[model samples]
Target: MCEANAYVRQDGVEELFLEGVDKVVPMDNQLYLENIFGQKKMIAGTIKELSLVDHKIIIEKI
Candidate 1:
């Protein structure tokens, strides 16, 4: 999965933005991130921001 800070730019909608992530995070599925905190400490939500930057994508939950 392409994980990165994807900047969702909407033409006539609300813009979206998220931090460095690690999942495409489907709108219906979800996007979760992990750090030194551990696995269970990750955040899950509907993906919002969807963009492709050099084959990498930034995803955020709705």
Candidate 2:
């Protein structure tokens, strides 16, 4: 229930990146995201915003 959906912001638009993301790990210059279903992704970006109440996470891709 604490999982959050992830989004990537580009050109002022936000796009869904991952859903139900429960884990986020910073490795080097990228972020490692893991979802509750064990889905994973590595994205090169910085966190823009985190809305816990909305269960959303926004990242600005570099």
Candidate 3:
């Protein structure tokens, strides 16, 4: 329940990228997102914001 949903901010809008994200790993200039269900997504981007209270993780694509 502590897990947060990840979003990608684009053109002044936030789009949901992943739900129940548990971890984020950065390697080889790419970001790896792992959800509670072990679903993974790798993308080229930078972390923009972490709103723990709101349970949101925002990323901006490179």
Candidate 4:
């Protein structure tokens, strides 16, 4: 239940990228996202916000 939904801010809009993201690791210049279901993704972006109450992880593309 600690996992949060990940979103990417594009053109001032927040778009859902991943659900149940449980871990985030920074490697090189990309961010690695691991979900509770063992799914993973790597993205080149900067963290914009962490809305714990809303369970949202917002990131902005660089």
Residues 1-62, model 4: lDDT tens digits: 79999999999999999999999997877899999999999999979899999999999887
Model 4, total clashes? 0
lDDT of each: 0.41, 0.94, 0.93, 0.93
38 in model 2: Cα distance from truth in Å? Answer: 0.5
CA shift of 37, model 3, Å: 1.0
Off by over 4 Å in 1: 1-3, 12-16, 27-62
Model 2 per-residue lDDT at 44: 95
Q: Which candidate tops lDDT?
A: 2
lDDT of 1: 0.41
- TM-score of candidate 2 on Cα atoms, chains taken together: 0.95
Instruction: For residues 1-62, write the lDDT of model 3, one tens digit per residue.
Output: 88999999999899999999999998876789999998999989999999999999999999
Candidate 1 TM-score to native: 0.32
Predicted candidate 1 versus true structure: per-residue lDDT over 1-62, tens digit per residue: 45455444345444324444554423235544442223322334544434566433433334
Q: What is the lDDT of residue 12 in candidate 4?
A: 94
Write the candidate numbers in order of decreasing TM-score: 2, 4, 3, 1
The residue-by-residue lDDT of candidate 2 on 1-62, one tens digit each, is 99999999999998999999999998887999999999999999889899999999999887
